[model samples]
Structure formats: C-alpha cells, structure tokens
Target: MLLTIEDLTKTFPGTVALDGVCFDLRAGEVHALLGENGAGKSTLVKCLTGVHARDSGTIWLEGKEISPASTLEAQEAGIGTVYQEVNLLPNLTVAENLTFGRQPTRFGMVSGRKMRAEAEAMLAGYGLDHVNVTRELGTYSVAVQQIVAIARAVALSGKVLILDEPTASLDARETETLFQVVRGLRERGLGIVFISHFLDQVFEISDRLTVLRNGRHITTADTAGMDRLELIHHMLGHELEEAEGRRRHRQGGVERLQVRGLARRGKIEPFDLTVREGEVIGLAGLLGSGRTETADVLFGRTPPDRGDATDADGPIDLRTPRTAIAAGFGYAPEDRKTDGVIADLSVRENIALALQARRGWTKPIPRAEQRRLANDYIRRLDIRTPGAEKAVGDLSGGNQQKVVLARWLAMNPRFLILDEPTRGIDVGAHAEILKLIGELTAQGMSILLISSEFDELIAASDRVIVVRDRRHVSELVGEEIETGRIIDAIAAHENGEGAMTP
Candidate 1:
C-alpha cells in the first residue's frame, strides 16, 4: 500500500466526526473518497493532511508509521492537498505563485527568467500552453488557476495528492483535461485521493472506491464492478426494495405563474414558461445551459430585458428581489454558503431573516416569537443543531441548506424557486428534502426546480423546460420527461434547430 489509515477517529465538541475509518491507497491507482457533505470525508482529509490531529489512528506512509503534526510536516513528508477552493495568491503572477517558497535564487537575487522558464515548462506538461506565466494568476479563468495549483503540488514531488472537488466549477471540456492530467499522474506512481459530487466522472476515473456514511466506514469496492445505482445504494445504505418504493408526485391544476417573452441580454433568451400550483417544474440542461440564469431572472436577481409574470390578478412587474418577495416569490440560490446563509447569525436569527427583512429590520420579531418559529422549522426540517442559539455556520452543509430553505418557507411564498437545493448534501437529507418539496406542493405551493442530476429531474418534476445557449428550446411535459429526451432537446437547442417553446 502507498498509504494506510487504520482506526482513524476524530471528534469535535459534541460530534464524533469520524469513527474508526480505515482506507488504503496504492501507487498507480486513482482512489475515490466517496461520501456525502458531512459524512466525515472532509474530516478524514483534514486528519491526513495534519490540519486536525486524529484522536486515534495509525497512518503509515511507504510502510513506515508517520503521524504528521502539522500541514507543513505533511507536505515535507510528500503529501499535497488541493482544496475545493483555489488556495493560491490572486495578486501574484503564475510563476511566483507556483514557486513562492521554493524559489531558486542566484547570488541572493530573485531569478525571474529561471522561474518563468520553469513555469512555462510545467504548464506545457499539463497541456496548458496559452496562459502566460508572467500574468497575475487571477487574470486567468478558474480552470487555468486550478491547473496551476495542481502543477505546483505535483512539482513538489509529493507521493500522494488529495484533490477535493477540483472540478466543481469546471465544464465538460475542462474536466476532460483534468482527467488526462490525473491519469498521467497515476501512471507516474502517484497515489491520488479524488473527491467529487459528480458520480459519472467518479466512475470514469476512479480505480477503486471507499464510501463513508454518517461518519463511519461503509465499504470499499472496485469501480469496474459497480454500476451507478449500486454505488448510490452503497453510499445511501439502502436496499433495492427501499430504492424502488420512492414515490414522486405529478403536475396538477392550472398555471399559477406565467412568464411571457422572458429575455435577458447575453444571459437568457426570450422564453416563456407556465408553472402551476401543486407541481414541480424542472429546468433541465447541461452546465451553461441557462437553467440557473432562468431561475435568476424569475427571482429578480437578474432582471429580464423583456418579460412579464402574471397570475389570476394579471401582469406584475418584478424589477428586484424585494418586489419579487413582496409579490409572494421566494428563491433558494445555488451556493448556500455564499449566497444563502448568514454565517455569523444564530440559527434563530437566520431562520427569521427573510420574515424580518420583509417586516423591516427595525420592526424586529419578538424574542419569544423568533425562538418559536426557529424551533418549529428546526423540528419540521429535521435540522441538526444544538439549539436556536447555535451559529448557522456551526452546522453541517446539509443543515445550513435547511436553514436557507426555512428562511424562505417562513415567508410562505406562492412561488418557490429552488436552484440545486439538495446539491452537496447526504442521501438521507436529499430524500427528506425531496419529500418535503412534494409535501409543500400538495399543500398548494408552486415550485421551479433546477438540478444537474438528470435522474432527479425526471423523477420529481412534472414538466421540464430545456434550455441551451441562453435560449429556451423545448418543454418536456407529462410522459416525455426521460433522460434521452432531455438530452436531445438540449442538443437541438444548442444547434438552433428547435423553435422556442414554453
């Protein structure tokens, strides 16, 4: 084994983050660390990189016991970590960022020429020749910056590399490039620890997989022997019987929100859609297919250049989120941590935020009322937290998402737009949230759902609107919401072969 982790245990104040988790990595193999957001995957990575010392464990590197006490020590021992968020200095040039600490100086003077030559060679090796090494790293796209970060790590001659969701923001083409780089690294005998939410890519690149659920080791299996459903089942710890019994509702009733000739310059085209109460309308397409953009336009985050939304009351103009909310519309943005949650606020404060905003901050909800509302949502959504007083940031990713959802639900909006609300959450939490959506619709709420998971869209959505290249292409109604149909619609839209449809 290139690396062995035995009996690894880590605990926070009141939570056992990891429980006797064991894993092994071998040279020339791409080992995937599969788990839900709070399933101890991050904790295990932190422990291995010495960001958090394990409570109890034996970590062996190259057949010798090695317990790194600090991140620097781990790096010195041939371990490199690339986090989900790029960690390079934005202001520095690519060359400087690459060789910041290990720069080679001639006669005690910084050697710019030597650094540029080395950086250029590194970029060429990674199939990235267009980016200028002399330019500031931030001047390049996120994909290029990610490549530079990877090159810097590999240049350190690290025997093991841990990549945490490196392709989260990358498109398909960029992801293909990343896979090639990873494959080259594996061929060079570097053990890679890959973590991703994209299951298809995981199967494409991973040689072996180790799954974790609820902070415990679940199983380790060969990627070749596992199908997508089998992998999902293992991660969720559900039998085939339970998987088959998941019931999803269908669309019912007349249109509640109607958008006519919706257009956003350079973002989304003039498209029309009708969303009905007691139904889930899914927006389907690949990345950059204008799905999220449509959500933004509907929520008034990105105002439409030309459009009108109507109810039985007739056409209403939504120029801003405040207007949208006042008109009984609520939106749960895609990035919960950045756009949804208020990190410093307590759970009670976060849950009551939207309601408080609607009533003006000066007219604060009474302490008793706030606590009651918070407790109600906490119990209703099954959000795990110590109490209402706990900071929203202190909770797990899934819980944070629940807090965001509660913030919107507290307002009791007529139209709810959820943009990948369950992304990066656990299977149990995902099912719970999906079921909650169904329950809400049954109670007569209208929903516009956007998700990258095609299967999820097909299952939960009553109708799907497919978009491509900032234009609405086609609408998939009842009995036509299959994966193949969705893909074909997207393709037709991209090729400009379909008439704009609602």
Candidate 2:
C-alpha cells in the first residue's frame, strides 16, 4: 500500500464528522472516496491533507506513521491536492501561477524566463502545449485552467495526487483530455485519490471504492465486480419498502403551473413542465445537472431568456423575483446563507420580508402584525429560536432553514420550489423537514422538490424527473420508482440511452 489509514476520527461541536474511518490507496491505482454531502468524505480528506487535526487515528505511508502538520507539510510529504475551483491566482500569468513561491532567483532577483520555460515544458507533457505560459491564467477556458492546475501539482513532489471534483465543469472533450493526463499519472506509479458525485465516472476511472455514510465508513470494494445498484444502496443505506401509510399527502388535482420553453443562456436548456396542486415533482440528478437552474428560472431568480408560464388564469411573465412573488410563487433556494436570510436582522424582520414586499414599503407592515406573523410561523414550523427578536444568524443551520421557509410561507404561495432542503442539516432536522413536506402537500400546496438524495426523492415525490447534462431525459412514477431504476436511468443517460418513458 502507498497510503493506509486506521480508525481515523474527527469531531466538531454537536456532531461527529468522522467516526472510525479507515481507507487505503496503492501506488498506480485510482482510489475513489464516495459519499453524499456531510458524509465525512471532506473531513477525512481534510485530516489526511492536514486542513484539520484528527482526534485519533494513524496514517502510514510506505509502512511508516506520519502526521502532516499543515498543507505545506503535506506537500513536502509528497501529497498534493487540486480543488474543484482552480485555486491558482487568475491575475498572474500561467507560468507565474505555476511557479508562484518557487521562482528561480539569480543574485536575489526573480527569474521570469526560467519560470516560463519550466511551466511550458510541464504543460507540454500534459498535452497543454497550446496554452501560452506568458498569458494570464484567467484568459484560458476552465478546462485549460484545470489542466494547468494538475500540471503544476504533479510538477511538485506529488507522489499522491488528490483531484476533488476535477471534471465537474468540463465538457465531454475536456473530460476525456483530463482522463488522458490522469492515466499517464497512474502509469507513473503515483497514487491517485479521486472524489466526485458522478457514479459513472467513478466506475470508469477507479480501481477501488470506499463508501461513507453518516460520518462512518460503510464498506470498501473493488470496482470490477460491484454493480451500480449495490454501490448506490451502500451510499444511501436504505431499501425500498411498500409506500403505505407514509404516502398520505398526494392529492390528485388539476395542473397549477405550466412552463413552456423555459431556459437561460448557458445555464439550462429549454424545458417544459406541468406541475399540479398537491403534487410533489422531484427534480433528480447529480450536481450541476440543471436542477437548481430549472428552479431559478421558475422562481425568477435567474430570469428566462425566452419562456412563458401560466397558471389557470393567463400567460404570466416571470421577469424578476418580485414578479414571481406577486404571482403566488415561493422559492427556497439551495444555498440558504448567501441568498436566503438577512442574518443581521431579527427573526421577525426576516420572516416579514416577503409579505412586506407584497404590501409595498410605503405601507410598512404594522410592527404588531409583523410580531404576530413571526410568532405564528415560529410555532407553526417549530423553528428553534431564542425569541422572535433574536438574530437569525445566531440560530443553528436547521433553524436558519426554517426561517427561510417561513419567509415564503408568510406570503401564502400557490406554488413552492424547494432545492435541497435537507442538505447539511442534522439528522433530526432532516426527518422534521421530510414530515413537513408531507403535511404541506396534503393540505393542497403544489411543490417542485429538488434533491440529489435518491431515497428522499423516492419517499416524498409523486413523480421523479431524471435530469442529465442540463436537460430532462426520463421520469418515473408510483410503483415504478426504485433505487435501481433511478441508477439505471442516470447510467442510461451517460451511455446515451435515456429518453422519454413509454
């Protein structure tokens, strides 16, 4: 083994991020670390790369125990990491970014010529000879920047290269280009750790797999014999049971929203959808599959270039967020921190935002009415707040999410769009959010629920639309929706077979 870990563990306030996690990698093999968000994959990686100190565990490289004290120390120990977003300085030239701190010096003067020469030679080895070393890195396409990042990392003393979501933003050709570079590294006997949410890519590139769930290692298996269904089951930790008492909320009704040719430039391809009242239509796919993009268009967060939406009333143009709000649409975006709440304000103030917007600023919502609205929803949603007067920023993640929901609920929306409502929240909070979905839909609210977790979508949705490459490819409904089929559908898309269901 080139690298081995035994009983690695890490903890943070109110949660254990990693519990007795163990994994290993061999020279010349691509080892994949697989998990959903908050599954301790990041924590374990951080521990190995010295971004966080582990509470307990042992790491061995070449049969010798070694603890990397920092990122610099990790690099010196022959482990180098490249993140999802290329972290190289965009302001600098490709050569400058590549040789940032290690510029050759002659008489204590920096040597630009030496740096560019070294960078050009390194890039040529990775089939990136077309990239001008003297040009600013930001001027290159994302794919070119990614190759530059990999070249720089491998040029350093990197015995083990960690590529985290390296091909996330690349197109098909770009991804193939990256794979060629990776294969070459593998041939050079360098251990590689690849972390990504794409199942097909993992099976295509990895030699072995390690699964993590709820901050603990579930299982590890060689890729040759393992099937995709088994792998998804290991990651999700669930089996499909009869949808009996659990599915009481699906009230059949007429369509409440009809969107035709809705799309934004370079965000999502044009798509059509019909969502009826009391229906939970789940948008299912991996990350960057246009789930959030679809929701953004529906809610007017990202205005559509060419599209028309209609309720039973008439043709409606969602040109902006306020238009969406006025038309009885509610959207709780995926990211709650940057887009959702006014952290500095009181809970009462945050919850009252939407309704006040509807009422207009001149006719400010009465202070007493705002307090009543806040208290009612705080109890209705069971938001854990010190008081309605407490700053929303001071609350836990789950509570902060509730406050965002309350803001929309206050407006009495006819259509609601929720993107990843259960992500990054505690387990207890997850259950509560799921239950609330059932209650809201049972009471005749229409919803478009988007999530990456297949089980959550299967358990709560009336229809699950499988999206791939920013387009809706297939769908599954009651009695037909299972984990295996969903995995197959996703795989089918990758292999160019996913299409409209018969």
Q: Among these predicted structures, which one has the highest TM-score?
A: 1
Off by over 4 Å in 1: 89-96, 104-114, 130-144, 170-174, 197-200, 225-252, 367-369, 372-382, 493-502
**lDDT by residue for model 1 (304-333), tens:** 888788988888777789988988899988
Per-residue error at 106 for model 2, in Å? 6.9
lDDT of 2 at 197: 65
Q: What lDDT tens digits, residue by residue, belong to model 2 across residues 318-344?
A: 988899888888898866857889899
lDDT of each: 0.83, 0.80
lDDT at residue 362 of model 1 (Cα atoms): 90
Q: How far is 41's C-alpha from truth in model 1 (Å)?
A: 1.1
Q: All candidates' TM-scores?
A: 0.87, 0.64
